[model samples]
Target: MSTPFSPRLIKGGLVLVDPDTAQVQRVIALQYNAESLRRELKGQESGEAGTDRAEPTRFKGVALETISFEADLDATDQLEFPDQHASAVAHGLAPQIALLESLSQPSSAQLRKVNSQASSGMLEIAPMLAPLLLLVWGAGRVIPVKLASFSVTEQAFDPALNPIHAKASFGLRVLTVDDLGFASKGGALFMSHLQNREQLAAKAQPVSLATLGVTGI
Candidate 1:
């Protein structure tokens, strides 16, 4: 029942997951108008021995650093789904709202309640919010990230004033070792994905020219 894979055909897109439950909450399959990828390096400036110029004496501040990126989501496809057809303007917005809301309210943990009476104060808090996981496998790279910011703009309302077309812009910060400490299923998977990516990158490196017989030039 599955179609055969072909290099000519492109497959897969951005995936979002609930960090607490490790469930695939949403998948963004449309082509975004724009997407940004950022990387940062940390270091200290040090003066050279006999020069007036100072150079950056860089070092890895964190074992793994976080990167941030922004992307836009649009609901303009008439063939998206039955509920997302052209006439179903409100329905077109449901999935986008669900995606954004899931990021904002991924999971909750219990906290100690404060009360005057000791016995009553010992109750646990109901909902302690947690973050969401963003996975991007585009550009021949696999990256696990955390949802940083999300904003949506609904436009093209129908006669009922329901949003028929909308665009959502969101930012994601790549997860690092610091963010993978949580013992949730998503957290564990995030860590494993990072490790696997690193391994694959290492394997793709070209060996030294000495390893080849034509290196005498």
Candidate 2:
């Protein structure tokens, strides 16, 4: 269907379009007057320039004589409505769509929740994915990534052992790192590294270990 409607120039020569259905609209004139143009530049010099918002711009004076039609868009494309006026087409026009609204700041909280659930599921399948990726990538000669990394780490720390010395290893839980670092400064690490049991018993300096003997009277 086609109909000729009156064209109106909106702000700054932007023509207003409200073609409800498919229709072709022809661009007419956008000219100005010669005397009005002369009056607009009367006080200025012959080579004067405008310095408003748009630099190097032409002024459409009161005259409409110098107007011309610019074929901005072909008549084949549908008319576009500004975003605020046209919002019903946002959700793919479907009721059962997952992302049900416009993608904006207000939808961020819901998007985050959906992403969180998806991430948890991805993590759960990570172990399976690792072996699959390794198999797909390795082609049977190479080992799986996780096991190979663990084996390599263990090989890097192969410690030396002496045959004559009976080694001792124990865990002593302490309160804090300040206390631990202070103890280390006073040779706690040197004493900790000492492995010989006979040497430890011979060099064990006696300081009365602090113990609070609690009794229910």
Best by TM-score: 1
- Tens-digit lDDT string for candidate 1 (4-106): 7645434335676666666877676544534555665344345666776775554323344455444454445654565646544555466656655566553
Residue-pair clashes, model 1: 0
- TM-scores of the candidates are 0.54, 0.11
lDDT of 2 by residue, 71-118 (tens): 121111111333542322232112111121121122555667667777
Clashing pairs in 1: none
Worst 10 residues of 1 by lDDT: 108-117
Q: How close is candidate 1 to the true structure, as a TM-score?
A: 0.54
Report residue 152 deviation for candidate 1 (angstroms): 1.8
Score candidate 2 by lDDT.
Answer: 0.23
Native RMSD of candidate 2 (Å): 43.0
Tell me, by lDDT, which candidate is best: 1
